[model samples]
Target chain A: MFFQILDILGTIAFAISGVLIALNKKMDPFGVLIIAFVTAVGGGSLRDVLIGIQPVSWMTNMTYVYVIFGATVFAVLFRNKLNYLRKSLFLFDTIGIGLYTVVGIEKGIVADLHPIICISLGTMTACFGGVIRDILCNEIPVIFRKEIYATACILGGLTYFLLREFMSDTNFVFVIAGIIVIVVRLLAVKFRISLPSLYKDKP
Target chain B: MFFQILDILGTIAFAISGVLIALNKKMDPFGVLIIAFVTAVGGGSLRDVLIGIQPVSWMTNMTYVYVIFGATVFAVLFRNKLNYLRKSLFLFDTIGIGLYTVVGIEKGIVADLHPIICISLGTMTACFGGVIRDILCNEIPVIFRKEIYATACILGGLTYFLLREFMSDTNFVFVIAGIIVIVVRLLAVKFRISLPSLYKDKP
Candidate 1:
């Protein structure tokens, strides 16, 4: 129940991030809605597709649609009031990643996929929405450029698996692991941590 | 044999389109490469995911990677001289859509999925890459906007299935249907044809 609440909050956070970027780009309202919707639901869409869920999550769940709509309106109208948007965007984005990582891993476990695939799914579910957001904003995806974006999620997912092995209390494991992801991401941003470019032939 | 050639041409055309957009966006060499890859392979990725293909198309075939690589290099070097890009792009993108419509439908048929899902896959395979490209370029997808994009492919797919049921000459049917998609898309662009906007929700 706590996780679900946090998950909705994360979705709202991501949606706000997307809408703010769209506003920065001076997109139309329809385009802004799309940006919010995609950013909020894109990662989970990929996860749902891979897990063979028909109708897609956003299609099946009206709650996500409402969250994105509400977030968009809030972000657009309260832009000045949310003066810390630039300062707090990363934090909200990181929180979303942490929540998504936990949910992704749990979903993968439920699907009975291999541990390796589960970790990959967790990382993907955590990072891909932001990736989609950055891409749609005509910028390189944050994860591909800054390894820290994905690194934090991977570490959290790994910790999740380890904790789940010993700590039978699932919610506790999720919360602690989520904190690990949020901390790692915040630290990475605070310290400007990133990966070295490997551009010998990558381009 | 024809489908193989068409697929290769479609990939090159799509990669070239991506390179053009990357150039317009003033992307770096790595950005160009990444966008090129995504534009060329994204539709197929969505198709594979939705249709539940194991390993995915690009993952299973290294040749697709080579095609994208070669095309990206060609596009970057010759972009200045490609005076006929707009028309050529429309042509090849249309051809890719037509071929993938058939390919996706066939795959779905083999998998014994419902006809509705198969049609959805076909449309996805034909249109989703361009959607990704436009989204990455910070625009609502061209397909979703105007000029008979997905609509053309969907119409062509319907024609192909109808022709397959009624016509005995498979090769002739394929050629005729491919031509119809290409011609429809060309005429749409030539005549400024487009779909009505569904974006008129409450502002």
Candidate 2:
């Protein structure tokens, strides 16, 4: 029940973020909805596809679609009122990633994938939606540019595996791992932490 | 026998295109190979995933990896000479899209999808590899811009269904549909045709 609530909250937060970006880009209504849908479900869709799951998670579950639609509509109707909620939006986004990372890692484990691959799946699940949104909006993905976003997910995945060796209680492991992701991400943003660029110019 | 040759040729063409872009971006060797791999199989991977196919096409087929590796090595070593073969590259790219579209449509048909969805699948299969490449390279996707690229695939898909009504030979229909896609794409580029941008600024 707790996880389910966190999942819905995360979906709503992600969808709203997508809607805001689409509106800022001056996209049409159809484009706005598409962006919101992709942002809310894109990561899990990619993970499911990679793991060979059929029809994807969203196609099998209609709740995600409805939630995205509602969030998009709400965002568009209350655009003016959203400005003051930046802090809350950030909080939701952080919490969403944290929960999503643990869920992703668990899914990868169920599939019996390698630990590194599981970590990658977790990171992609939490971050690739923003990557897709930025691509569609014709901008460099914010995560790829200079953010500790994916790194936090990676660290969280590692935490989950490490804790698994010590505790057999699944729920306890999940909560602690999720909290680690949230704290790490929040700290990174607070301190302006970033990964170094790999780009290079000609000799 | 004929389709096998076309498939290999298309993979090589797509891999080369990716290598050229990665080189232009001045990415590292690993990055170059990553781009090449994604460009060669990303579209088909996406199509298979959407249709509920597991393990994706590339993971099960090692041939694609080998082809991409060979193409990347050849492209990087012979980068300067490649500039003079722009005409050949263009021809290969056109033929690649044509073949890929037909294959994508066939996959969709086998999966028992609606005709419209099949056409979309075909267009996505033929074009989305480049879209992925552009996104990774941090540029506006060339297709989403003014290019006549995806339009050609859609037309080819339409032609395939239309030809199927009159012809009983599956191979004949495939050949004709592929040719239509190739000719349309070639003519569009030859005449500098483009779709108008939907963007509109406030007065």
Candidate 3:
């Protein structure tokens, strides 16, 4: 029940973010709605498809679709007022990623994927929606370029596996792991930390 | 047997194109190889996942992996000489999309999806590899901007369903559909046809 609420909140956060980006790109209403839908469900759908889940989770459950639609409408209507809620939006987004990371890791574990693969899946689920959004908007994905976003997911996934070995309560481990992801990202952003550049300065 | 050969050739074409792009970006060897692999199989993998196919096609068949690797190496070694083979590369790419479009349509048909959805699947299979490649290389997807590429696949997919109403031979239909895609794209390029812009002049 708790996770479900977070998932819905996450979907709302993702959908709103998609709307903001699409509006920024001056997309038509249909395009904005489509982008919002894709941002809300793309990662989870990708995860489900990868593990061979039929119809995907969103198709089987209508809640996410409705949530995304509602969020898009709300976001579009309140676009002008959204600046006042930026901090709230960021908090929701952070919590969304934290929840999504653990959710992806759990799905990978269910599929019996390797630990490394699970970590990858976790990071992918938490990050790829933004990646797709950026691609459609014709910008470099913030996660790939400067953010510590995916790294936080990876660390959380690693923590999930590590905690599993020591903790008997799986639910407790899940909550802890999710919190770890959220806290790490929050701290990283607050400290203005970033990953080292892969390329050196051109001579 | 013929389709399988074309599939291999298509993989090679896609992989070589990926290498060319990665080289242009001055990516290191690992980045180049990753791009080639993604370009060769990204579309098919996406299709498989959506249809709930486990392990994906490339994971089950090692042939694509070997082909992409070999193609990447060959393209890198002959990079300087590749300008002379641009026409050949273009032909191969055209053929690749043709085959991939038909293949995706077949998968969608087998899954008993709607014709409209099947057409979307076909277009996705034929064009998304390049879309993903451009996304990774931090550029707008060429198909979305200036090409008649995906339109050809959609047209071919429509032809498949239309021909199915009269044709008794399934293989013949497949071949015709593939040929339609190739011919449409060839004609579009030769005639400089393009999709009309959706946005009006700002001024």
Candidate 4:
């Protein structure tokens, strides 16, 4: 129940983020929806493929398409109104990361992979979609550049496992971990915090 | 033995395609290599995932990395000589489409899917990387706009199935079908031939 709700929210939030980025880049309606679709489900799609899931998650169900299309319409209509999204975009982005991380980890657990792989999948599902979206938009991925993005997912995933061990209530564990991730990501963005670039020779 | 040789040639050709595209885009040296790497392997990687292959082909072999890097260095040093690419690029690209189609179809066969899925995978493997590369470069995919792109793979794959049913020597089948695809694509390019666009609504 908790997961289903979080999954939908993550899709919406990620779609919104992608749409805004496309708008910022002056993309058309079709292009904006492509961005939104990739952002909302790219990582999970990749994960499902790696783990050998068939027909993929999104192709089987049309809800994700609806979400992306709805988000596209919303973004196109409200594009001018969203001009000031530059400042508060991180808040919505945080919720996306947190929710996607949980869903990815859960999917991994269901697949019965090793815990380490679960964490890796969780991190990827939380990050790579945005990376794909940004790259296709002709920009460096946000995770590669700023905001301690994947870091928040890793930490949150660890916290998820820890809470799972201590608290038998799966509902409470997921809720707490999800909130922690969102809060950490929010603070990271609020403070403009980021990791040191491995290749730090450039401005 | 034949598929192996074709696969290696296709990898090199795909890498060159990527390197040239990145250079044209004015990416830095590392950036160029990364783009080339992804472009060369992206279609196959995507194909593997869609069909539920594990570890991803590039990740498992690591040789794919070496192939992309080698091709990148060669392309970079000889950038000024790419006028010759207009001459040889067609041959290489056709060979790539032919080889990739075979490999994609084989993967689907291994996964026990239907003939339609095999054809789709073959086409995807042959064409999807270029689609991704063009999208990342912020251009509409050249294949989607240009002469004889996915059509080459579709025809080549059809030839493959026909040859497989009539003959058992894998090398003979791969080579014959490959030449057919290369000839078809080259003739089309020489004639400036193409299919109709689905999105063109103009009267």
| Candidate 3 accuracy as TM-score | 0.63
TM-score, every prediction:
0.57, 0.61, 0.63, 0.58
lDDT for each of the candidates? 0.77, 0.85, 0.85, 0.77
Candidate with more favorable, higher TM-score: 3 or 4: 3
Candidate 4, B1-203: lDDT as tens digits: 75566677788888888878876666555446556866788888899876667657765565677777888888888878977776576567678887787778889888999877898898898888888777766688887766787887788778877888999897688677667777778788889888866766842
Which residue pairs clash in candidate 3?
none
Pairs that collide in candidate 2 are: none
For A47-147, candidate 2 gives per-residue lDDT tens digits of 98879776677755667777888989899888889988888888888888998788788889899999889888888889999988887888778887677
Poorest lDDT segment (10 consecutive residues) of candidate 4 chain A: A194-203
Candidate 3 lDDT, A1-203, residue by residue in tens? 87889888888999999999887776655556657977877887778876777656665566877798899989988899999989989999999999999888889888999999988888888888888888777876777778688888988988989989999998899899899999999999999987877779831
DockQ of each: 0.11, 0.17, 0.18, 0.13
Docking class of 2: incorrect
TM-score of chain A of 2: 0.94
List of chain A TM-scores, every candidate: 0.88, 0.94, 0.96, 0.87
Q: Write the per-residue lDDT of candidate 4 for residues A1-203, one digit (tens) a residue.
A: 75666567668778888888888898887888899999988998887887777677899999888877887787678778775774445565677788888888888788776665677678879888987898888775545334567778878888989878888997688777778888877787678776543332653
The better-scoring model by lDDT among 2 and 4 is 2
Better of 1 and 4 by TM-score: 4
For model 1, residues B1-203, the per-residue Cα lDDT tens digits are 75788899898888888888877766555556667877887887888875677446664466788899899989888888877676777778778877777677667778898767776777787788878877776777877655687777677667767788889986676576666667777788788887866678732
Question: Could you give candidate 3's per-residue lDDT for residues B76-161 as a string of tens digits?
Answer: 99999999999888889999999999988888888777676677678778888887888789875666556678888988999999
